[model samples]
Target: MPRIPGGATGVVLALLLAACTGGPGDAASDEEAAQSPADPAFVADNEAWRAERRAALLEPDGWASLIGLHWIELPAHYVGSGATNGIRLAKGPEKLGMLQQQGGRVWLVPDPGAALTVDDAPAKERIELLPDVSGTPTIVAFDEGKGQLSLVDRGGRKALRVKHAEAASLTGLGPLEYWPADPAWRVQARFVAHPQGKTIPIMDITSRQAPQPNPGAIEFEHGGAGYRLEALEGEDGGLFLVFADRTSGHGSYGAGRYLYTAAPDAEGRVLVDFNRAYNPPCVFTDFATCPLPPPENRLDLAVTAGEKKYRRP
Candidate 1:
């Protein structure tokens, strides 16, 4: 529930506080006061709001616990040795199960009549066994040429397919801390135009290759340091970014954290608020494969804004 800058509640609070102080007969004046131009205090309040959200994202139960990753290869056999091998199930001592591959498709055989379910639906034949984050047996089926899967559970919910693997935020945990939130990190960045539309490659927890759309980069300045962030287009059309700054490795998440921005305005402008940057899903579980920021996305300067590393469970 940490607030991000420009969040909705802050606007409501400002209006309510104004009403409490204004005369009942001067409602129009109160409305005008609320609509007045932004002030220095308003900017400070926004920064504080962003800081709260930053902290919440890095908190335990956030997305950083991902610590294991495995890929489903052709002839998907479940190997049970070593830490990074095949799928690590929460089942019994057997540790490993049987997997078969035929016609470019893979399937798993749960212990005979294993009370398994896919997305809460009763078990079905010829379906893919997926990791169950909800503590139930789940299966998934993929379309012929599509990268996504159709997930089904034991109870019957068809949910979006997701993979399990150790995320960078989970593995790169050293000391969970952050630099103080300095307003200097809040800067107006210019979005560069990329008419051709760039493509950024991402490797999921399964080490599967997925191509993310890169619309362009945001250029900003902080404390005499200049930085650029390359934007990745989310499946929902939102903006996503994986970036590393000077504090990475030593102070921030080694693989890097994520940030999002709304679509650009008519003038093609957006605020690259570092105060809202947060840890990736890998920070909370070992079942998330988060993409690391590419070399070009690594910034040489320190960005002292947003949440620090997560320290508590």
Candidate 2:
């Protein structure tokens, strides 16, 4: 997989002359959306999906909840808001706990009398944990559950990602604007599966490199020009696409946008719907780990659709 999920690209290059395609889990959510429905009901469904996406983003622990990302550089460091801690927290209690890293393992030892919880239950003892990079990460909840902490593994570096319900992004986010929905932008694509167990290099905004599962590439036609995009394995079992278009920096997030598509059917047919495209989590919070679009996924044409650049207040 890709190094960071900020929040969390393209079809691979060998197929650039070909075609291709994360947010909101399974995307517009209508895997069975008619090939090109321009009807009012279809439009309404897309609107509803967008509303859900907006709500999800503002969840207490959603991307907007992120407030800080502190790298764990030292072997042992105290974490808290006090000035004495080695790894000082920007928020939370003055003396939360101690973090000890040794022999490739990290453990959290909460300070006595500090009110901390492990996954919602009171943290009565020290806890061994893994970073978000490999498997499920343990959430260290503090400040009476209003704030929480978790470990993230980025390019072999472990860091703490802090989140809180009071983070500014949750209440300060702007409304999402979209280009007029059009059925024409919903192009039909064909999935060409790669050989069993193939992976490709994925470069993140930080320029870190990692091999991501490359199930195959998706080929499609848009505006009379044929194109292809390399597909990454989405956590939801569908395909994830990272792409950049002519709108970058002008009307969209400069790095690019992301989209999630349902798995190709038996015949390998899929819909590359532009209306469902969305901004990466980085657009909302600086604490995110977003990946950049692979060169192959950069499109010459402007994709005048989907969520626009998020203007931070």
- Can you tell me which runs of candidate 2 are displaced by over 4 Å? 1-37
Clash count in backbone of candidate 2: 16
- What lDDT tens digits, residue by residue, belong to model 1 across residues 77-175? 553323543644332223234556555334555443344344555443555544343444443311111111222222222222332223245345454
- Residue-level lDDT of model 2, residues 1-313, one tens digit each, is 3211221123222132232222222223322234444789768878998999988987898888888888889898998989999888777989988998988788999987679998678896888767887678899998888899999887787888899998888767788877656677787899989997998787765556777788899998875788888888875557899887766655666677898888788899988888888998888887877776777787766676787778887
Q: What is the alpha-carbon lDDT of model 1 when measured against the actual structure?
A: 0.50
Give all TM-scores, in the order shown: 0.58, 0.86
Clashes of each: 37, 16
User: Ten-residue segment with the worst summed lDDT in candidate 2?
Assistant: 3-12
